[model samples]
Structures are given as C-alpha cells and as structure tokens.
Target: MISLEHANRIVGATLEKGKALGLKPLTVAVLDAGGDLVAFARSDHSSAMRPQIAMGKAGGALALGVSSRTVGDMAADRPSFIASLGPISRHGVIPAAGGVLITDGNGTLLGAVGVTGDTSDNDESCALAGIESAGLKAKN
Candidate 1:
C-alpha cells in the first residue's frame, strides 16, 4: 500500500527546498500504485496549473510504470504517441517534468512523486530530497 505519511513528508520537504531556492511556489503530489493521488499540496502564490502539472507527472509514472522523464524523452522522438496519450486514460498520460518513479532497494514500485512550478532540474532536486527522506530512490 502507499504510505500517506511518507507522501506528506515528501511534499513538505519538496516545498521547503523549493522555497529555500527561491523558486516559484509549486504544487506537489504523491500518487499510489494506481496513480491516484495519495497526497497533494500547493504552496502560497501557486497557480491553478501547478496541481494538474504535478498530477500529470504522477499519473504518467504510474501508467507507464516508468519514470515520466523517460516518457518525455521518448516522446521527443515520437510526438504522435505523446499526443495520442492525451485521449487515453487521462491520468495515465503525463509528460511534464517533475514526475519520478519511487522504488525501494528491491526495485519494487512504491508509487511516484510529482512537483511543478520550477524548472525541470529544480523540480528534480526537490523530488530527490523527498525520495531520499523516505529511504527510497527516484527512478530518474
């Protein structure tokens, strides 16, 4: 099962790290094995777009059973597939940055985390912190 406590802690950590970096307020999300949101948070001044962006990343990870970044890179070579993903399982097709696969040492799927409102690299760093906090690793 997904860990709600871990989810909350991760989002909180990501937000704190983002704020420390002076990045814009963001939306963060934790999704379960099914890609359903386990936890979600939005920082002050964050726009409505943030949540969906984070959700898209989480959804993409759960649906593809792979890191969203990989999906994005593959889409670069096949834009049509990415386009087609829009109509398919709405939650299953996310392409934005900040989505990452969460896995344990055994490589078992734990779920995913998604962050938005910052550059891809910054979002990634925040995610890295949270994943590490949970003693799990982000699958790129």
Candidate 2:
C-alpha cells in the first residue's frame, strides 16, 4: 500500500526534478498497489493529455508489476498482443518509459510513479528519482 503522503512526496519530487533539469512541464501520477491513483500533479503549461498519459504509465506498470520500459519492449516485440490489451485496460496502457514500480526495502510492491511531458528517458529518470527521494526502490 502507498500512503497519500508518500504519493504526494513522490509527485513533488518528480515534478521538482523536471523543473530543476529545465525540462518541459510535467504531469506526475502515483498509484496504489491495485493501480488506483493515489496522488497526481500537473505542471502549468503541460498539455491537457499529460495527466492521462501519466496515469496510463502508472496503471500499466501496476498491472504488469514491472517498469513501463519493459512493457514498451514487450509491446515492441509483440504488437498484436499488446494491442489486444486495449479493451482490458479502460484507463489504457502506455507501454513506454516514465513508469516505474515502487518497492519497499523488503522488495514488496508498494505502487508506482509515472511522469510525462519530457523525453522517455528523462521521464523515467524523474520517476526513479521520486521513488529514491521517498527512500523507496524503483523496480525498473
């Protein structure tokens, strides 16, 4: 389980990293173990679609129990099967970077953090930083 406070901290850290790096404004999302949103933040000037993109990344990570980067690879290898997932994931799954799984010191899955509005690598890095800022490990 991920506490709301923890989610908030993660989002804050993720957004701060984007700002510090002078990247485009970002939308960050934190999800609980069950893939429900726990906290979210979108920076000003970010595209309207950013929130949905961020949520998709988080939900995709939670559903697969792996980083979205891995999902992206899987999708790339099997486009048809990945496309079939569309109906199942009402919130959608973005099989891309920027989504990372959150784990505890004991390697238990806590949740996930997703970042958008920057390059895939930067978004992923920011999400990892957010997880690290909360003293959690990112299973990416």
Candidate 3:
C-alpha cells in the first residue's frame, strides 16, 4: 500500500527540491483513493490557507479521476458541469493550480497530489516530481 508516510516522503523530497530551486513555501497534500488526506505538509513559511487549497485540488482530482489540469480544461469547455461540481464537491472543488492524479504501476487510481505557493506551473512540476519519486504515475 502507498501509505501516508510514503506520500509524505515524496512531498518532503519535492519541497526540499523546491527550496533548493528558490521556490516559495508551499502546502502539499496527498489523498488516498477515497479522496481522503493520507499525507499533508506545509512549509515553515507557508500560509494557513495553503493546506486547504492543496486538499481541495487533490480532492477534485480524486473525485474526477483525472488531473486537475484536465479539470480546468473541462471547466473551460463545460462551464455547466464545472459549476455544478463546485457545490457537489463541497470540499474537493479547487479547480486551481497544482493538482494531479496519482496512479499505481498498473494505472489504478491510488490518490492525488496538490501543491501551492509558486505559480501553478511550478506547483504542478513539484507535485509531479513528488508523485514520480514515490514510484507512482502522474500526468506529466
């Protein structure tokens, strides 16, 4: 099983990389297949809201079974469905930066990763690195 510690290790490693690269402090989250937080971390300087934002993004990815980037594109093309999802998600409706789908080697939905602090692109890259380092898959 991809335990919470495994996920946190990935998030921590990615954060270390981000710090080395001069990125801002961030909040990172990893969810289980049930869209529940299995791991979560916030940089020393990260804002209090960062964790919630990360969780929201991760939740969205898990619920849709797609990357948050795809969710953004879908929301752009289908506003109705996207809008409806806002209320439906309740806790998983971020549709923002730094969210990704996590999968097993066989492409099973394992969970998701979400990051916040830098630009969405940077967040995405960090999250991708974290997931990949954990021997999981993410839509790069």
Provide the overall lDDT of each model, using Cα atoms, as 2-decimal numbers: 0.81, 0.89, 0.80
Full candidate order by TM-score, most accurate first: 2, 1, 3
Better of 2 and 3 by TM-score: 2
- TM-score between model 1 and native: 0.92
Q: Write the per-residue lDDT of candidate 1 for residues 25-128, one digit (tens) a residue.
A: 87889988777789999888887777878888888877887777777887889989887886786565667568888887887788899888888878878888
Write the residue-wise lDDT of candidate 3 on 63-129 in tens digits.
7877777888888898788778867784557776589987788877777888888988888888888
Q: Single out the weakest 10-residue window by summed lDDT for candidate 2.
A: 82-91
- Give each model a TM-score: 0.92, 0.96, 0.90
Ranking by lDDT: 2, 1, 3
Against the true structure, whose TM-score is highest? 2
- Stretches off by above 4 angstroms in model 2 are none
Q: After superposition, how far is residue 101 of candidate 2 from its true place, in Å?
A: 0.5
lDDT of 1: 0.81
